[model samples]
Target chain A: MAHDRQPPPNPTSQSGLPLRAAYGIEDVPADHRASIGILPGEAPFHRGCFAQGYRTKPWRIFQLSGYGKPEDENERIKFLLKTGETGFLMEHDRSTADHLYNVDHPDVVARREDVGMTGAPMQSVRDTHLCLDGIPIETTYGHAGGAVVQHGPFALAAYWTVARRRGLDLASLPGTGQSDFFLTYLGCVTKQQVPTQAGLRLNADIIEFCGEHLPKWVPVSIAAYNGGDTGLNAYEELGALVANAIEYLDEIRRRGRMDITAAASRCGGVNFRTTMDIFEDAAKLRAARKMWHRLLTERYGVSDERALRLRIHVVTSGSKMTYQQPLNNIVRGTLMALTAVLGGAQSLGVSGYDEALSVPSEHAHQMSVRIQQILQHETNLAAVADPLGGSYYVESLTAELERRAWSFVDEVAAQGGFLATLDSGWLHARARANQIKEFADEQSGRRVVVGVTDFTDDVSPFVVDGFPGVNDAYDVALERLRAVRRERHEQGARKALVALEARCRGSANIMPAMMDALDQEVTLGEIGEVYRAVWGDWQTPELV
Target chain B: MTAGQRRILLVKTALDGHWRGLSVVAHALRDAGFHVIMGGMISGAEIVRAAVDEDVDLVGLNVGGHTLVVERVIGELRAARPQLPIFAGGVLPPSACRRLGELGVETYPPGSSLEAIVDAARRLTQVHAEPDAAPP
Candidate 1:
């Protein structure tokens, strides 16, 4: 199926650089002199997080694995773990999880088949328990799925409640809660969510709660991956992420609860996407650490090095993985993962080869891990961090990305900060514009995606229609929802719901009460009902 | 090239919020002298309401999730306004495309050309009649 198409005469990238014959010191720029000399452990960590690189600790092979019923998802997680995966990410069903709706919600019931297609249908603590069955939550690094803005507290509380039920201490848990605004507002706007302001408040509450109780937790990771996958380019992705961090940090400052350093540390565990634009995407990550260091030091006036050190988890771009000749996407996945590794990500999730077609098959997931393994072992690439550090094109691109991103950050700030832009649909417009440009570029043949825009035949016998997730997810979820309702202490559940409502109305942190709600077995939809009554829905901007 | 010249009704049959493909397609449609009314995460009833109220000649369904739900929307739209022409785009696989094609609804999956899409809009809306075809 491979077409031997000739490379274009002018193969220079968006940046006007000649296709090099591989030069050395002459390629290193003068202005970027200071940054080039800095080692991986030093300031402006463009090279990597630590000086020793993977020799100290190999990059965490973190695959985003979940789907179907809670028990099924749990089995998958254990499988990933057995395959040497370092972390577990619990993904909630988008229909229920993203909307904060339960299985019985009319909206969810309407598309019942779609339920748990993207993730496990975990609606309560019992479901969470079932999902975490036989897994040690205390030691293992985990991601409790709150991938939407509104569902953050419920997901975290549910996960924690299950841990608590297992006699694990909240203060000693090591995990993360992804109450990402980019996922909610930019990439996949939920049908109904609390307004951005309210969402921000909720994130702040989670941050404060995590800071006090779960010390080893990333409260809210501003997933620039969502923003990037939506349409934002490398620079825009960097800027928006920083601007998002500012929103959280500023909110913490206004609230005057925990130290700003502590909040920054909690917010520092961020995620970005690595696309097929290997050089630029790699530059984006290198530039990211520098920006984080600068933002914490120069802007916030924070001196804590730990707070300045940005921990990154990169998921290979799902959009880059094509639907056509799905097997070819393995090469795309390898290349994207290589970019992340070269960029020195602390953790990585290679989007499965069958990403465009469907959620990953078990084989696809293992292949994703294998790609990372091959890069880690077969190639001595991991030994040197930011190997492209001093090259004129890379350094210039890094600085240029940083400069442009700061401008975008200013634009975001001018629009009354990140949350405000989301509230007004301004950010969506920005992403939409870029998305249009991307499509137009492809249409004009300026962007050539092999096997898609050109060379569109597959000789391979293998055909991947996609792995259909468990069909029993809806039935199981419905049964579980009924079971939880039937079994839970009704009076306690009612009391918990009232307390949750009061907290929503009051100036109190919602997490403590949220945890209580989960303990009392107040269902996800009940909490959603309270949220609707108190904060009202976010007015989404018309992007499509 | 004036504003609100060619009317297009853009609706997502599924509640899935993966808006990247749809937004880009909608922009291209609008840029090609079309009025794009975003029917955000709408159901079949809402799609019918927008199509009837907006009086759009062409309906663009951004099918992010299952194609069956989209088929349901198409069925409802056909029942409400039999004359309306519909086209679909999103993460549809080849089989899904064939299914949509069987229903006379053109499918534009990922990697589809904006030019092709714009041309389809013109033909479906009867703004420009199909070449070599006699009037229906």
Candidate 2:
């Protein structure tokens, strides 16, 4: 099976725009006068989000920290904090946490050695407590370790339960929980997650719950980073993100539990990925803010300027980092970070050089932090907001992305909505189509990723025998699950589980019942058991 | 040359569902005329069952977890069908790649080209094509 491939001799942008020799007056005439008058803080905010960008609030250095046992994750968080990390994201073990299984579940037990490969084993609240040990939850803007939709309620409730134990007020506490459909349904599809319908209900419940209490918490951030990394192009990423937001807002409206404007505000904090394409991706951030503002105003009639402002967090593309010359990824990480920074991101996480191999080593984690730190301190890049605001090339690209993204959103709309696309594998087909092209592009030498496709020779002295995380993560997690099962009040746990099962089968909010379950020290797998019984499993669409 | 299509079984040994890489490989192999059976994120026992039951000439394991798990899955596959030619590609670190290579399972870590993977698949299935070859 050979391909009669046509190698593109000339350079084109990742979004398929052929490069021009130079952009003079023809790119955008009158671009610098009236259109450029829209400053950083103005409406249709493609320029920037804030009046003063990193000057007022520097992008949060929020590298995800986890691995090994609970305490190991805690130690790593503290280490990151001491090493100039402004914020931390708790990462729950993917096998146990993402699937909402305990270490003892038959599925998890099959490959027990892989239990803590990605993150800490946060089965019960006790384990969550251990993961959050000594970390200042009151002051810190932390991610509560629930990246999956089904797992979000448990993760948030457990974190809030700990905050309550410390006598902190819920209204004033600041943090976020990512009940992202992209992570759950698209990027890393778990074995048996709740269907996307159930996921939307869970996320909407979180939004309403957060509205009443936990006012400062960004309940469910739509992380299009996962979608982009999975192979959605720039405009597609933007389109899918907003389309995803509409699912949440419409669900909340259907419930009629909270104000639509308030719901829009709660879900405004979004995440995008910055890849190697610096100008286009930066323009994507600009386009994203503009699209978000328009979506809130035109659709929902959101009048609050603050509610209209979309906060952006950029996670540098992990799949972009090469495995051949691992150290070369440091430069890749730095460049992606700069792309995010130049795009006026409110937060950033550079993928560790050893990202493809395993969880970050202490050194790799430090390097991730240093990359952000260097951008913030040494580089004068953050001195002004949207420094590339008036550039004819950037503005043109931003408008082009906005035009394409809206059309993508409309395509999603025609297929019912975002969740419908996931259910029907429509979005997956789109991603796979792009994936084929990307691989073929590289195969035909149209794309030259250094050390992977073109510069195949490596002469570096540095040997990054990728970090294999803690070996005892499984053993420790198994013991802890057993101990937690043994130590907690059996009756209280049973009572909580029964009540939780009732809510899952009924129409009431799942968060209150979830909080009760967390209060009674119910294990993640127990809640998972109830969910599986009540909701059954999501019939995952044919992926390949 | 084999008269029928060269069948290849691609299974994710670990439960983690990072299947984008696996999907691409499966697509590439299918394009190259191998009968690619996606066994999905299944257990070791299930993977072995699929390999033997499907009578695949080559097995591609998407290692989303530890090499130890992959090693155990490979052991199961080899025990079930001693003549099977196995290969792996996923989040395999340098050491894990070396470890799997020692066990005669070719490793394609991240950034591996589709051309190389397809070539490896053809070569591996060819090596395991005949019935009287030395046990792998």
Candidate 3:
């Protein structure tokens, strides 16, 4: 049912901030005007991070790649790398990895056919090794597959153990472990997960361990992309992200072991999502950096310039990709990728054209890389950093976003903090409200999604049926789990698990024991058992 | 119209818990005056049991995984209750959609509007308002 009424004269940003037809110097807020002249690479880096943005270092072409067996995922990763992907992200099966269950778990067995539909099932370090078989660990920047909170230690330990096996120094290893709260608590909540408090402790332990040993590794990335894609608006995404960071930094400071600046620097490598709202999202990124700088200086009283500048990895919003005319998503991907470049992202992953249907096929994955390649090579879009910095409209919108975002941050803080809000389901309620509003907007014709609403008919001959990951993932994973249990030294495995359980029980770091456990072939389910026994499961807040 | 009331059982065939689509559809179904039972992430046996126990007129399976699992679930449901119509949604590829359609299940993949889904629910369950009943 299309709306017959005329549209309102004045429109607003996606976050509900009103916009004027024209903006001038008067429209730019006074406080923001002072920083308007500030250059990239300077303090409070709203403009950008590096003065010579892509010229000095082009944004890394990092794409999420994984599914099926470990070998199958490795093949896809190799394909992406050959097609000019600068970095690779390993994704683990949600059925196995997100829940920390082995292939034989009753829950997984019930859905055996769905085992590796989302990502590879790496139940043990051997499977992780197979996933990284030919990939170079020392030089290439890898994202070890631990997107879930409870799974982070095992994934990171597996990656590190593999590196050590290759005789690589832990200090020189560079990769990111995504133990993000937004993913764990809000976006894709697993059926069973450690409580938020336990998750915080695990993340702190990872950060501390990384600081002491794997100095180059990004201990944990705060992916607000999950929050945004799950339905938090632009301003709320920024505010909630900052709130999450505050929780991490405050915990680290309370421990009083590691220096806060290093902890802040570790937290700097954050991720955000760019949607079809190009200008607003680009403005959101700018506001994000500035808000991060202000948070560090104002709240924590830290002056390390390196720690103030937030590094961003933008993944174009997958929710924006329509499933109707799947080919149209390629253009959407390009536009969103351009926004990320305009926003001065350090790295970017374009959501595949078939995102609405399934994980990217080989062709769709290549198209994702090609879209970034075209932007980086053909258009010269990366020549100047923060290209949208000076325009009156963009500047005004950026300042407005920053002001509103800070206020939202204050609101979240007033409600006890990010994790508390998540535990209380307050954030989920906000996201659900936005989801309803957005859906209603589409239904009422206020927001017309092409192909879905307006252009319903398709004339193209090509059919996009989505990627069908290998059928044998479940069988192979089950065989490998049996092999690991049978071949590994049973006594050593039990001892390592006992040590890990002790570490989990006490206040000490759990990584060393975790590494030993993985090295001894302690399967994922056993570790999950230990966690369940010690910390217990988080009571997932109710959501419709 | 049914004599007493029409009910629909919504269940997830896999363990993935992203509920944005399911929530919208459930709200629309409730608004349209259907009894909506949310069966969160249940097995094929559990789904069949729930369908029989709740006496649902229709079954909506949120298929987020392999078609084989969904096919099996649909098979079990059909075996248990021959008359219960089934519809599916969530990340189903075109091939999977076609396969499910072959099994007599209407498929609403991503990008299907809430109105279309609600209309599908009504049509599938054959639940229409009585002239004397109050408006929704």
Candidate 4:
């Protein structure tokens, strides 16, 4: 029920690329170099990450699941796993985890009812344990919920400590902690947290700590999906993600801690977002791998083939889901999932049909999982590798995207770097410009957003209201925090906090102290206090 | 453009620090000749404090969390200034929008145009006509 309207004589993609009615061999640009002859899994691995693709290793069906009390999120995780999810991502409550405030903190206390609206409030190891109650972390891929930069060390340590207690080897454990800058600094800026320089230290520490141990863990995934959904167009998202990788590699190199090759491999597991711009978004994934290869080989002088291949996790853009006709988003999710499959994403999460309204209901989440299942099994998607490999239009778009992205990379470089752009509000300005333009396009009927703009004849009888969430989330979390504080051995917790504070102040890897702190049952707020004392707050630039 | 230049205070009810929506609304209001004060990720007390301190004509809220949180903020604002008009936009579900609407706060969910939001700001502010609010 969308996109059926006749074109406006001239149409452009979300990134402002002029559209055409038809294409041929000549449409593929003359200046565009040959990715045409390169095979999948080869150098400049934009075609596909693997030669046979889904035949060898199917893309991981990863979904972000959490809300309310620890047990509530735990039940949801178990349900997702039971219903054929390949990996689990634990989401920490934004109110508590994002700001590193326990439920009892004054700011959190001010808004008590909002505690678990975004995610489960996991304050200590016990809460994390309850969240992972029956999940087999040793065998399965786990996401320790540290999407915010400041909370990374605490979140990872809590998850790792739980694994160690279950007699799982840290070296063999497979998981990731998203110490992503784009999520906070660029996308969702926290109210008060460590400055970007300190956040870089936290991420670098995680990388070094994971390099020495936890070989299987993707230490800190740069989820550029945050940057993308925030308002970055396709090429800008690709360019900014590359610029972020450069920052990580440069820091690791400067420290002379781990081999840059190994660091590149660990940092390669990044993320991007797909929206309603189906073809452009699909081209984005293709452009991403090639850019990674170019960045590592041309810039970093890295040669290891294993380290060169970029493993991407694609999340369908959440902002694209409309509240006007919520059920239409199910179709939106499916099409975006299909785009990811076409683009050869290594992992994917389709935003729920009720995404604009609230966190996905049980049924909404199940539909998210089912969307991927149907794509993998019912369709013949898994039967081919690089199915769009030879399409003239796709290849032209791929090359066009790469060229435009490199220019954007240069644009970011002139702003100092990705992190500098973030700090200076340059990146936010770019995102804001694009956001205003896109909104204006929709407002002027230059863009038709299906049920939102043109086709508004939705007649679904289902009452698809947003998730109400558990009423007792705040009370239960408050009780849990009190219980942990009252029950944990105080002296040990104090010692660990002191040590963590020292590590934050000194030039030491903060992970060991963080792990010890978590093991000693130190709460999230204590760690927050230490970081606050050490780094102070990031003065967010004037956004309005 | 109106009886006088209107001032609006935009505050985020939750600590979820996404400024995209708030910034867009502020841009539109300012473009339409309203003085917009962006209160970044503040609580109800802080929001009320800003509204009263700034002596703004209208208060615009950006809700990223629960309806209850918005309700609490609405109560605080009402207590502080009875004549103050409040309008909200963000990730408000239909139910949350209805709940907030029942409290006399005009709710704009996702997909609501900037035109509608700016129009509401003008209308809500004009409804709150006080002799002191107009710039002499």
Candidate 5:
């Protein structure tokens, strides 16, 4: 099929944008031209964030690594760290962590084998402690796995509680929590969650709490990678991310607790997904920084440069890692990481080669880190920031993306903000539309995904059924749950539970009580019970 | 209608929310003129309930989890609606593919062409323009 399409005029352009043979600077819009001369580290940071680029600081080799039991996950984390992974991410199992449910929860009991298929199952503060065993949380940039909305408070509190148990000051903790609504509500919607309004309240509380304590923490990163993976194209991903930031900032402003600039700075450390459509995805990141600067300065009327500079973490698109010939995904990872660098990201995590089969194998995790290492050390690509900065195609695409994204942001605003759109299922519809279109393109051969739809032959010698993870995860989790209930101080647990319920009912930030609950040895399922009682379940919108 | 419209049952075997494959197939089957009922992440009992209640002409299963669970769903659906034709898709390895085929269900793993899927739908539903002839 690859040979059959030889003279097809490269069916799609390098940018995934339609192309003509050539063009002049005149074709660039007047609005675009005004910002043409803006350098990196300047206003409307369309070019890049740093003037020195990689020469000053290379992008961090931040890989997402976790699986099996807590100790097992910790061992894997330490292994990755030894492999020179600059930062570590704690991945919680979706069935337990994402929904804040314990393994004994009926929904989880139904899929026992899937308990730790995705990540480690942490059911209590003891499990959290086990996951953090031997890891230096005080220095390294840690991503405590709160990637879902409903689970954020529990996950963050558990990590902080572990830090406190280690005699580390809460004010000096240097980890970030990902209480991303996009992941929970949109991308991979769980069977249940707290209402969107309740989620907003929790996120705002996290932001406000982090502002006063844990000065080094990025409260909640708005990961557009979820949106993109769920099928939002480049422009839509950019638009929805900005819209999502607006929801956080607006909620904080309404609370009237923290400065809007501080909130903007905290929320500005966002994430995006980079695909093989290198130039377009790179332009998307470039456009992301510019759009963030404009949105903060114009909408919030804030002039703090720190608040305006958008810092991004890019995870190479996992969906783009084809399952056909698994080894090819390594090349795909490298290319996507290059696109991220071209777009000038602050940090990056390359998707594992065996992504379609399962989570990353230890070797696959090593390759992911090695991919970033090669790019940082050998490619000379990082020596200059936004190397595609002044190119007419790139600059033009970046400006066009910003224009389109802002319009999308406006559309979200008109619908009464991001949370409103999510509640109303309007955003899901948009993502569904892009998803359908992309599938149609691949189906009709207008776009070709090299290994799967085209280039069918494979020469690989090794078979990849992917990592099955440890079989003992379920057994260990059950034993731990019993141990916690059997061993812990029952009186303190009951008292903390009551306090948690009271805080949930009242207007106070739930984090302090949440920390207390963790310290008193409250389990995840118990906390989930309080959440369900107070907030109730969100009515999920059906896409069908 | 010229005759009774053909009804097809579509369901996901796992709670994983990746819906690109299901949505595309659903759209293509609908385009090819069949009533496609989506049973999202339902249990085996629920799958059987929908298959019987809808009186579906064909059943399509989207699987991303254990083959054992999918096998259970298939057995229940077959016991409930013995005459209904069945097909499966999504991340099915060669071993799983042969096993599902042994159960008398056609399998379309990733990279199955939409044209081929539409053809399978038409054949499974007996909706060809010339129904007197055998399927290709």
Candidate 6:
């Protein structure tokens, strides 16, 4: 009981906006001060998309490694790619990939010690080739762990059938899969899914099957960092991620089959979170690349300046980590990884100074990669690209957060858009009214969450005890699901589970019968029993 | 204080649904009046048949996995409600909150506090009166 730091008389921001002790160029709005003198790969790119940012690409140290057995998440993704981690994320096992269960699924054999404690119970394609064994995947950039939208066509057809059994070339594969509708229709709501209109027709059939054969795949990303860590407020996570990329570019232009500028450059590889509000989350990645170049040139006329440049990827928030001075969350993951590298993150992922308790104890994932390699080799912050570009309080909070995120994307297009405000829970009651006004501003000390509500004395005798992953990940995923149901080809895995239940009852693309039911080994609970017998779940709604 | 309404329940000892910390501790135990009951990711014989068919006087859980499946659902809800009273929260870890505080449960974890989880659900459902004398 010793709190007296005094700063909150009115300072607002984590989406309540208001803070201004000094900002002027007439508080930055006359047409965003003419795009603050343009340049950083121009065209409303909000001074980014790279004019030598991180001196031509440095921000990619992607993390989110996996947990227990698929060879213990392939030896913790080859120990985060030999402890530097410039891209690798596979984490699938939300009690069997968000309930596509197997590991003897009677609700995962009645919580068989919660199977690989949050990832690494791959299940088939020989446990995703023992979680991609020698991890080359044609020069790694992978993240094929279907961050759940009915486990994204079985984790991108088991990471493109282990990169077409290592000969590679599903049109030269790369990464990213998250079949996200804000991570299970609004950040972690999976009790069983497949119903935001069949997860928007399976993310418009994985953006028209990655515009015909994984064109360097990033197929379905749309993770507004799971709707701003499930309480959406950086202008409602940039107006529900531009109303979820206008429902995946109006269901790929009402199915004209590719070419809405290559499906807005494969929905411009998004993902945002960067939390410790450092200048409104570095002016929310410069107002999310000026609202993806004003939603692809004023609603889809697009004209491709690389499909209007919005390629962010930040992670940092994990509900702004603080479980009573856990090493003050490595200085809140180095000020949200230097606010995702001065808000121009091309890729990042800090969240884990034992993130509010568990997951990531390999020294809190090598201190989240030595806080991004000491902000990329001792802070010249990669010699600037949009280092708070023309700051009049970050261009008046990036033009008032793109004018209140285009009026919350016109109130999610008058509520019949972003999956009809996530099937009418109205964006989970606007992320439960910003998580009850951020837990009523940390229970009214006016949000002073330092060491959890103002320096609550820790005396750190250091104790983390988190990542307790492999306890024989459910008896070795029930002996590799009974040796892939007694070694494969059982009538070609029942004719690839009857052509993946006739392409989930005929629409067309269920990722080529989910890569022929993960190449006839068909197991993740028999493709979640043919998607719980053709999408008969998702009645979810009652969120709270 | 616990004459009429008390209830509680909760559930999710893991199949990982992530109901935002069980929907903010079931909206602070239904804003302190109690009667919660979510029970989402079930099974420990369906949480001892919903704690002897929802005659719950407290049972929380949540624990997104392994403290031996929340000590086998707190030994099947203390073998079907032996004076029921339990508490837990997600992503535990501080040695699984000292082995679920040596099995007498009460472990909130992740920066807990919806007024210390509704004052530990009004002292584990004895409902010691004043939340404007309950029943809102």
Please, what are the lDDT tens digits per residue for candidate 2 over residues A1-544?
2243345677777877666766654675453335676989888787887888778898999999888889999999999999999889999989998888888888888899898788888888888888889999899999997899999999999999999998999999999999999989999988999999998888988999999998899999999999998989999999999999999998888899799989999999999999999999998999899899899889889999999999998999998988888888899999999999889899999999988778898999999999988888898988988988878788778877888899999999999999999999999999998888898888877777877876667789888887767889888878887887888899999999999888888878888989989999899999899999989999899999
Model 3 alpha-carbon miss at residue A495, Å:
0.4
Question: Which stretches in model 3 have alpha-carbon errors above 4 Å?
Answer: A1-8, B1-5, B127-136
Which regions of candidate 5 deviate over 4 angstroms?
A: A6-16, B1-3, B75-86, B93-105, B124-136
Q: For candidate 6, lDDT tens digit of each residue in A1-544?
A: 5476678888888889898788778988898898798878887888898788878789898989777788888888888889998889888878788878787868778878777776788878888898888989788899888888888888888889878878788887888888888888787877777788887888889888888988888888888988888888887898788888888898789878788988899879988888888888888788888888888888888887887888988889887887777778889889988988888889898978877666787778888988899889987888968867898998898888889888988988887788878877888888887887788778877887877766777787877777776788788778768877887779988998998888889988888888887888888788888878888887777788
Positional deviation of residue A128's Cα in model 3 after best superposition, in angstroms: 1.0
lDDT of 4 by residue, A471-532 (tens): 89999988888998999999999999999899999988999999999999999998999999
What does TM-score give for chain A of every model?
0.96, 0.97, 0.98, 0.98, 0.98, 0.38
Interface RMSD of each: 1.5, 0.9, 1.0, 0.9, 2.2, 9.0
List, residue by residue over A1-544, the lDDT tens digit for candidate 3.
Answer: 3434456566778878898888899999988888888888887888998888789999999999999999999999999999999999999998888888898999899999999898999999898889998998788999997999999999999999999988999999989999989998998888889999999999999999999999899999999999998889999999999999999999999999899999999889999999998899999999899899999999898898888889999999999999888899999999999999999999999999999988899999999999999999999897888888888999998999888888889999888999899999999889888988898888877777888877677898988888988899999999989999999999999999999999999999999999999899999999999999999999888777
Tens digits of per-residue lDDT for model 1, A141-220 = 99998989899999999999898888888888998889998999999988898998899999999999999999998898
Winning candidate number (lDDT): 3
Candidate whose DockQ is highest: 2
Model-by-model lDDT, in order?
A: 0.85, 0.89, 0.90, 0.89, 0.85, 0.82
Which is better, 1 or 4, measured by TM-score? 4
Model 2's lDDT to the true fold?
Answer: 0.89
Error of 4 at A70 (Å): 0.7
- The prediction achieving the highest TM-score against the true structure is 4
The order of the candidates by DockQ, greatest first, is: 2, 4, 3, 1, 5, 6
The CAPRI classification for model 4 reads as: medium
Kindly list the per-residue Cα lDDT of model 1 for residues B1-136, writing each as its tens digit: 3554778899776667888887778778877888888888777877888888887788998876666677888888888777788999886877788889999999887777888999999888874333322212
Q: How close is candidate 4 to the true structure, as a TM-score?
A: 0.97
Model 1: reference contacts kept, as a fraction: 0.62
TM-score of each: 0.93, 0.97, 0.96, 0.97, 0.94, 0.37
Deviation in angstroms for A201 in model 3? 1.0
